[model samples]
Target: MDTMKRLGGDAFAPQTTYLNSASTGLIPAAGVAAMHEGVQATAAGRPLDHFRDVEAARAAFARLAGVPARQVATGASVAVYAGLIAASLPDGAEVLLSEDDFSSLVNPFHSRPGLKVRTVALEDLADSVRPGTDLVAFSQVQSADGRIAAVDAVREAARAHGARTLVDASQSAGWLPLPQADFLVAVGFKWLMGPRGITYLVVPEDLGGLTPLLAGWVAGEQPWDSCYGPVAELAHSARRFDISPSLYSYAGAVAGFELLDHLGIAAVRAHDAALADRFRAGLAELGHTPVHAPGSAIVSVPGLGARQPQLSAAGIEVSDRAGNLRASFHLYNSSDDVDRLLHSLT
Candidate 1:
């Protein structure tokens, strides 16, 4: 409950002026330490202990996401997680998605044989739902514009048409409340403040029978059994999507979630919103217009190319997409960071 101790503020504070949690979160010292311990344990012939850490990490993430422990699965990357979602559907199933969704969410559908990808604008999503749609995948926050989607509405529309919902929470998982969906996937390196190579997917218990196409030994029903037979039956839980044990990265995620839980997601949300507001206000004052007038942690201001060189010269890190500059803020960011970014613009 002690927020400071639990969140590992000391470890994060000494790092770079890290405002880009949406890109890759700043890892806390605890996470680094945990990863080190996990690696050392693996080296000392105690690999089984690392598996314990992996399961513990999964349980911790499930608690933060308000799901049962078995409902959470870890993947090597967001793309892998999305692949699992795409594979759950029947071949050539029609997948409805947003035009503005992250490429990671769309590429899997393209790779699947017989899968048809349908794209729609964010605002027109409600009207686009049709009865034959098989899967609806979209991001809770648009990566380019940082516009928060009407996720609840989308979920309702998808359900009305008998479609399963797959939410890409890469940008909003730590900053906003996620709406209930049939499937949810997020990368730990983003808002969760964990290392890369770990992503999470949550699948509702009712749709648990969806076969995982990328089956692995670790995902087998009897993971501990050394006798290799036919690929063991895919697990009924979300763990079926996880192919192998990532004990080290999983330990880091556990440390990251511990910090997030200590801070309380409510506080994290408020902090990100306030910081984003400050950044938006500063950009407006500097004669820059944002793509989304009211933005979230990831704000995109137009005319980034004109301002990029100057900001880069000043050591201000920002992402330039097309003609917009993406400024992403996180829990560790303060009003000063916004001020510094604005000053670089001038």
Candidate 2:
């Protein structure tokens, strides 16, 4: 298929101008068809090996993340993986986090008693890493305003200080090239163009010192054999961290992953960023100064959040986050969508 047909022009048909991928991505036609097939199979009581879909999706995500399939753990939420990491930390271990990171990423550490959790400004996060900091955790992209973290700088800082790094790639995964970290977690619903209820965690080859807190039959060396009893042997790889698969969601995820694999992340990134840059230029022409996040696919205009409802009512999909009118572009979006939004704001 051609780029336009494969990416968005033909794969998606949104009634509204969808500029809210940061909120939730629109699953492509292939994903929707796969989901429909899954539902139909379930309704008909057909026997299908959904676990095959799970592993396929897992390997697909691993390819995007530049990791081996053995290092990826499939689950339903990023927070569950975050909690596992939290549970493995020793008491009073000092952790550094961004003040405004998504709560799922930050709250898990807080729930662990006796852990010292320190929050700092996003720009100051790398510098805040001190010798005693045991772990540094933050999102690769700020969900509120789409600020890309200085990942290389922060990772280098953590390495200098002997602090392990955890990055939440939920908002950045589909359109951004993920950096290596001790742990990385992402959900498929937002940018991977997959259904909700599927998330992934990339752990180090040694599993990043995390306990499989939510391990179930799926985490077994032989999942079917491990069911109805204690797992005789846990998976030797990161599969040990897997939660029971959500079969239907995994079906859709497999399709979404296939779509992304065919399109390629670098191509998607360039497409998304270009549209975002177009919107920024349009916003500038309209005399609106957006939040300073150069080269991000998400554009947030300060003090214009109140217009979100107005835009929505006018058939433009966007988000009002932390008092900013946030618009996120994706592989499926185009210059026309950017102009439509700009025209509405005018």
Candidate 3:
């Protein structure tokens, strides 16, 4: 499949190879069209319904997560859910997580007063938790090194230990089936191929009416009522967690979801796995060891800080983290991109 041309010609600039999907995905043409339609409608004083767009985005996100629509909520970012979850916990609560995970999931709790945040190796996530651990928070795929998380094992351990599980699926959801958790969040900008400023949160119905850390009118039963009188009741569904989303972002996210649905996620994952294997093999041939375990889509070549600039000069867009040259494979990447990267490295 010539995904580069099909997904969007505008998304893929000429002579540029984008291998940094882990950072920000190439926004699809569908997303761009959706955003434009929304902007134009509003400018014309005939605004498209914001509620309808957000609900569509939420449903699309739920489909990707393999969860029910009621289980999904739209938020500003993963930090919104992370902070709400953190604030829901009492001060001095013990949270078990990886030091390598993204800061959005960790820093919220760390910045809070009296919380004891304990760092564990990503490989030892399940083993690190024991009884009395209040929460287990981490990413399904580490953003730094792009290691696939053994989250099923962690979930099992968290269940046994009575610890609430929080998964940040920012790097994994569009690439793999999500692991069940008490709370799961994914940004639309990354693998979802949507605009930034949109995030989806999965909150199971069993969690019940959570007190919104940041309350708003939308979360209430009657947002349209001008009484300003009764609190009434918050939504029983994940709608309670929604503070609302950027209208344009929501529109783009809705379109992105539909595009992925048409492409089929299973095929997307297989393509990524193959690309990863090819890139790893190529990197090895270049005498550069891959930083992640076998078959990871995020390939890191450490201590090649200068090599990244040369690749950039050659029109390859990748990332450098902690002195490691990080190249992430997505559905858009082709074998040609891998060949280009490997040839540049040599």
Please tell me which predicted candidate would have the highest lDDT against the true structure.
2
Per-residue CA lDDT of candidate 1, range 147-216, in tens? 8888888889888988878888888877677668888888878888888887788888764556677667
Task: Tell me, by TM-score, which candidate is best.
Answer: 2
Q: Candidate 3, residues 1-346: lDDT per residue as tens digits?
A: 6442223324444358889988998777677787898899999999988788888888888887778998887888888789888888877789998976798899898888888889988888899998779899999888878888888999999889888889999988777777888889989898888889988889867753356766566666566651366547776677777775688987777766776787787777778878888888887777888786665778777888557788888799999887888888887788888888888888
Shift in Å, residue 44, candidate 2: 1.2
Report lDDT per candidate. Answer: 0.76, 0.88, 0.80
Better of 1 and 3 by TM-score: 3
Sort by lDDT, top down from the best: 2, 3, 1
- TM-score, every prediction: 0.91, 0.97, 0.93
C-alpha RMSD in Å of predicted model 1 compared with the true structure: 2.9
lDDT of 2 by residue, 1-346 (tens): 3322225557887888888999899888877887788788888999577788888999999998899999999998988888889899999899999988999899999999989999999999989999999999999999999999999999999999999999999999899998899899999899998888998999999888787777888899988898887788899999999988788788777766776777788888888888888888888899999989998989999999999999999999999999999999987777778888999989
Report the number of backbone clashes for model 2.
Answer: 0
lDDT for 82 (candidate 3):
90
Clashing pairs in 2: none
Clash-forming residue pairs, model 1:
92-114
